[model samples]
Target: MTETFTYTDDLQIEVVNEGTAKFEDQKPQALIDLKSWISDEIKAGNIEGWLPYNNFESSVTWKIIPK
Candidate 1:
């Protein structure tokens, strides 16, 4: 899915979803929104945290400060 989402040069963030998604007709917007969301998370100081005893959920949170 790398073709669907373009990464910045610095490479300090990652996005993960639990299941399949439909990006048809909104691929660009999805990427833009994803980046913006990540940027906002970093600006708000949201760091990756762990959730013990829950192996079915994702643990990493976005804290990527945009340049």
Candidate 2:
């Protein structure tokens, strides 16, 4: 499966996983990779003023796309 992460707001992140509906079949590693990438981007100052520390209990909305 493929995953896409979009920043819907300063503190809200939306995740769309494509090509499957079964939770058991979904790739857990993909989500972990996405989180790592986002964290790295934030630490690198790529997104100015959008620090993880500033967003308390940020929302992560997940969606699954049917094959």
Candidate 3:
């Protein structure tokens, strides 16, 4: 199933009937944006947690700061 959604501020992403999802690798653009967003969000005292996900169960997990 292909799930698509946008990011919102409330510290959680809204998924369509799939429950929240764990993001995969941070794309080139994602990496850049994450650096800034994460810093800002953390400073703002929104959420101090990290998200980690595996890619197709290959033992390769990517850590990301969700937007």
Among residues 3 or more apart in sequence or in different chains, the pairs in candidate 1 whose N, CA or C atoms overlap within 3 Å are none
Prediction 2 global C-alpha lDDT: 0.43
lDDT of 3 at 6: 39
Give one clash count per candidate, in the order shown.
Answer: 0, 0, 0
Q: Candidate 3, which segments miss by more than 4 Å at Cα?
A: 1-27, 48-67
The order by descending TM-score is 1, 2, 3
Report residue 12 deviation for candidate 1 (angstroms).
1.4
Q: 1-67 in candidate 2: lDDT tens per residue?
A: 3334545433544343333342235479745655676666666765422322213333233432232
Name model 1 segments beyond 4 Å from true: 1-11, 22-26, 49-67
Predicted candidate 1 versus true structure: per-residue lDDT over 1-67, tens digit per residue: 2122333665455444432443334468854665666666556766432221125442223333333
For model 3, residues 1-67, the per-residue Cα lDDT tens digits are: 1223334463333222221332334356643554455557556765443333243231111122356
lDDT of 1: 0.43
Query: Which 10-residue window in model 2 sums to the lowest lDDT?
Result: 48-57
Number of residue pairs clashing in candidate 2, backbone atoms closer than 3 angstroms, sequence gap of 3 or more or interchain: 0
Comparing 1 and 2 on TM-score, the stronger one: 1
